[model samples]
Target: MTSPLHTTRRAFTWMLGTALVGGASACGLSGTGGRGVIFRMGLRTAKAPGEESPGEFTTDTGWRIRLSSGVMVLGPIYIFENASPLEPTASAPRVLQRLGQWLLPTAHAHDGHFFSGGTVLGEWDREVVFDLLEEAGEVRELGRSPGIAGLARSFSLLLQPPSRALGAEGAALGGRSMILEGTASRQETHVPFRMALDFPPPVELQRVDFVPIAAELDEGGRFVVEVQPHRWFDGAHFDRVTVPEGGGVVDLTPDTQVYRALTLNVRRYTAFAGTWEPA
Candidate 1:
């Protein structure tokens, strides 16, 4: 089978910048003795011009919205060491399977962790489930694996709902993958809205890629997989939705107008703008 495609990126920046860490030939597939690499990752909101942070913004529809609780389950971040293999005959890099994979496959998201693949040097496990909104504003730790060897040409991220694998015991997230509880207001009308996004494994498989741009991971480099929250509501139409009387709560269940908008919103926003690393 053909290997995953590779992309080239000259430079990436927003409020943050993706710098060129570990030089081109810094390190590749090291053995027992060598300067190991620290793999860091996190989720951050896009920096709005006037705003200091990403959340707490208004939509184009004139409806003011804010995230009351933005709890989410994300995981299985695979960093492809040699994504673009020079040759097919080259032996696959070794995978140092960690013990129990961050608590084991049976672990929960609360105290347990669902670690995916192990490291290349047959050392520690590299993947884990993270509460993206749990530790907002701060760069939460992702696990560390020695030997930041080779070029991390590309990486794939798998974000799912609260599961035994995700280590989050469905935070009141009954029958849904993503639970978005917030309030929307228009003029003098303030309505509470609860949007439950159903992520049936298949939809949870979206990837953030910078193709045609050679985005490589460097040693001692810190990378964050940021998700722009506001981007999720891009091109969404709220004026067309019909809110229930009295309650004024817009329940965005599946198949509803607002529901469809939420679905498309995620699809459009769930992508990497580019790689950026602050000095």
Candidate 2:
């Protein structure tokens, strides 16, 4: 059994019905005796593992960091049919289907990764936009698709500001992008800090590696997508973080090294996006 991760995903979702074989469309799921697949997407933080509740902590630089809100805009999730992702192929990532449109990547190499060798298993038309710092138990159900075919080896999606990666649900952020806010204390004095990361266009993760396994519809089975924010703050130094005179933190600005740490951490941790488990 794959041990369940504490957090889920900040991306797209689908509800495929059956398996995919030769000449089969990912949407052509027609399985029996299953309620399809339901993805429980949520966020996880850098709190000490096994700790029942997240707690304020002093960073390595002796600054106390307390999180208040953590939001992330992500989506347009894609699952690949690349069972043997280790081998390079001539197939690039593609949009298996759209409401009435079809899109495929014409470019061959992206950031040095070869997408031309993979098959798109399915896609969630709507992007999932949520606050990563919300109560984990309140995380939403991203999608409930039918049974999926092939043991997917890679998952991909985009990390963007609310401006891009529009959610088909029409429930995305009105104008704000991402909100990462908290309280930092130095010398027993508390300072408020908030970082709103809003990069226009969008940051795309072509491939997020995960365990390869063809999933089946088990009566009690569910697919979970976890986005661990703790990983995103990896190597971030709170002492280097700057705060305003009365309130707010300047480290939220994109130009700061503290901001760079957050981005680098997210990229490094994307590979552990998720895994399918059985009952």
Candidate 3:
């Protein structure tokens, strides 16, 4: 049997869901891998109606996101914002579904070890997906997994100005920012996109520090920018990142193995412009 502490860590890691993968690296730049550069990222939560509380026995729809190793650096960005009529099975009040969106920018890597060579984020369209085991005794199962523990260590919010990573100034003062843009879990091409942030880069391991900013959903179930934070994906990849000198182009061909495990359908896109501010 897994230790209670370990199980809890895993659960907490996935609670952030897809945000955990990309949370370690932002600005479309990979980390130094060897800890030479402290990868700091800050992220805000994109809240919606169903996210707060699942209304009386409804299908609580949410998202569970996982990424490939390479995608971790390039980021597909996971999001679970936006809820439906799905009902939660757990007695835990947190059993309600959550709604939000996320974004990811093309990232550059110098050494393959940085944020390169793996899935960055994975997303599930429903929060129930993570409700794997419902025994109340297993509630702590979420705090175990080293991966989850690693994700928690990657976020923070202790600074003079609350280090919300809601603005460039705060991020600059703190180090880096990782704003969530939106999430896509279904096969349809019409999903709404919400945004948030992750700061500092290479989050300190096993530390719990993340502040969530709520976003309002539009009449059409789409998200409208309510609390605009710092920058989404770091100013649309505005900052110049350094790749290895003469490093060959990164082969981003999607691996079927990683795809199936993460359960995400890949797509090529070209629209990143939007009506929001860089916090």
Candidate 4:
């Protein structure tokens, strides 16, 4: 049987070709006349809508989670001039294009492979440690960078392990990319859990590529990244977590279903969103 990973990769490869052909008219190869602009960027964490408090939310499985602490290392943000080709807007043309790909003999040879061919509109290549429990409305400035003016359509970033240069913040994370301490309760079962994760598993899975966005970047602007940590546990099941014999905190590892679900969700593009505002 084909592994799920291989299946997903193969599907993505086909979608990639479809997107390239479908999005060509929208993302032309024409140059922007070398026009440049400087933009301010910021990042912040927010609770999913309807949550009563920061670091606190109830999962779909009836588990109520209250996190006492949360931290993450994220950076090297990139803005692309091309929108995600996989978007469902242009159905007829995409279907025709996909049919054409099906007839090509080289198509199967490119299965399970991927690449980005979009033009870079902006970037912030530095890593920053974020306190996921920070006030919801607070914005952490990421300095400024020069970029080409264009229609910003997609975003990408890397989730990095804490670096020593981050000083106390780095030390707090204990060399992990993310750390969360919290309590979860469902019905009569209550458990305290600590999850320290280098999410994406293989380390290189740190790169989150091509999240679709629609923003016009011109002259000068501000780019903002909002992270919703609560969504990271959307599919987690606290009831399945084994409680300690003496009532101690449970350390979540790869072996647990919660840990596995978190690893998959944290890398999901839905957990993060980016927008651009004109200055």
Candidate 5:
């Protein structure tokens, strides 16, 4: 058997590689550009100590995400008071493994559609799911090729049009609040396949206004939306935003995983624009 010290060393090395393969920068990923729209968002997740059926578990936690935006891309630079198991054991790595995947590269939205990176260990158990901005094509699924980095590397190969064309159709904006209504007809493994995240009841998506916000236009005419959370997970949260310019950004704050789930969308909005920091 490997010594504990050796095991720790291996874990550390593995984690480092994991961070590289799954981190935000690995894929030349960056925030979008625009007149940044910032928001203070509240989020909650559920978890439990005992095991459920195979490949499942329960957990519970919540957080508030402070998000900044560019026209199209959002990058979550911080996270706070999230929750997840510290290590993986024989029974399963359910929570930790899933958290690993999320923090790794589970979902990324671009142009209007969403692409998911499902496996980091090559072909051991890798998959990718796509969500389109329209309502025509069926959900496309691609099996990963052999290799630990195949899924991440072969990302471009799995391409399909969004079932519906993404448009400004019902998208509307107000003073500090805005709403864009769209549908994802296919079942996505974006959140729940590996874990269950629970939020408060009366969960519904609606228009919300983030006050005290501002927008700073850059030389490229891109805006970097910034905000400070009124409240957040350990005072932080993960946020996704659509940049007026075109793409979107996933504003990641320093966070820990408490649980996981599907059918829940956490969001944030800001009133004033400035460089964001811990408040």
Candidate 6:
């Protein structure tokens, strides 16, 4: 006859071995071969529809503006598996469905929220500085990164200053995230303006999040981000700009109305769009 304690110890050992084997099998099935896709990424700027010239457009306030130079620092892009609630698919029914899921006892047990920021499918955490005027009709490749195969529903990126390693591009920014040199004219008034924008203290990362995009990310895919610089001046009141005496280019300070408008418009979702292409 066997002792009861010895038999119980043996049973415990067998159960532990079975659990370890099951865990290993699950890991092998989900981890080893799931994230094998590689994606290339690029950035560029383009003229919005109805604009005949690359850097010249008429603002809504009747100011004909021509940008002589434009540069911006953008990076640390992240692609997510879930779409934003503002997207077309997020209707009244979808909200109710998510509410039902949230009501479940097991729903709150998961990591992340019920509505926003789903699993990260891919990321490029490098800061890149690109010339908006130079990339107007061309695409500049911003290195590749590994990604998992999934439906990329939305993406986000940071609009911080360029790294010092970016050399001249970084220096041109002068610790600012964006700089634009342009001249705006309305009737008899012409004002040449230089706008330098930077996010100051307490505002570390100027993240533009949840820009809706749909992409079936698979092998050899390329993600392209298109920026519309003209749209940045949509609500700008150029008439409010103080013209310097003797006709020098006016430097737009943070207090100016036009500068404030540009700052807000630059971060708007309509100013940027994303698309995926085959590599």
**What does candidate 6's lDDT look like per residue over 54-121, in tens digits?**
68888888999999998888876767666754443445687675464334221111243321445556
Candidate 3, residues 1-279: lDDT per residue as tens digits? 643233333343343443435543441354322111122122222222343311111111222221111101112122222221122325535423322112222222224322222322222211111111122112211111112111110111111112332344344323322222222232332222222222222222122121122222111121111111111121221112222355432221123222221112111111111111112
Output the worst ten-in-a-row residue range by lDDT, candidate 3: 67-76
Model 1 alpha-carbon miss at residue 26, Å: 14
What lDDT does the true structure give each of the candidates? 0.44, 0.47, 0.22, 0.70, 0.22, 0.70
- Model 4 C-alpha lDDT per residue in residues 1-279, reported as the tens digit of each score: 644344332243344435434344444446552356788888877766787676788887878888998889887677766665433355558777545433422112222223343656667766788887776547777788766667778776778677677899688877898888999998888889999988433333675665678877666678888887777897798778888788999999989999988877776665678877788
Q: How do all models score by TM-score?
A: 0.59, 0.60, 0.17, 0.75, 0.17, 0.76
Measured with C-alpha atoms, the lDDT of residue 144 in candidate 2 is 56
- The C-alpha stretches of model 5 lying farther than 4 A from their native spots are 1-163, 166-204, 216-220, 226-265, 268-279
RMSD after CA superposition, every candidate = 13.7, 11.2, 22.6, 8.2, 22.1, 12.8
lDDT of 5 by residue, 1-279 (tens): 643223332232343245434542332333342112222221111112242211122112332121121111112111111111222347775877546433542223233221222222221111112111121122222221222111111111111111122223212111112111211111221221111112221111221111121222122222122221121122211122212243333222213231111111223221112221111
Candidate 2 vs candidate 6, lDDT winner: 6
Candidate 2 on 1-279: residue-level lDDT in tens?
221221123321211112222214423454432223433332333344544434355554566567777666666555555443332334643332221111232223333233432544444444556655565433355655433444456555555545344554223455544567787677866666667665343233322332233544343344555665544554566566556666655546777766777655554423235555555
Q: What local lDDT score does residue 241 receive in model 4, on the 0 to 100 scale?
A: 82
Q: What TM-score does structure 3 among the candidates reach?
A: 0.17
- Candidate 1 lDDT (Cα, 0 to 1): 0.44
* Native-referenced Cα lDDT, model 4: 0.70
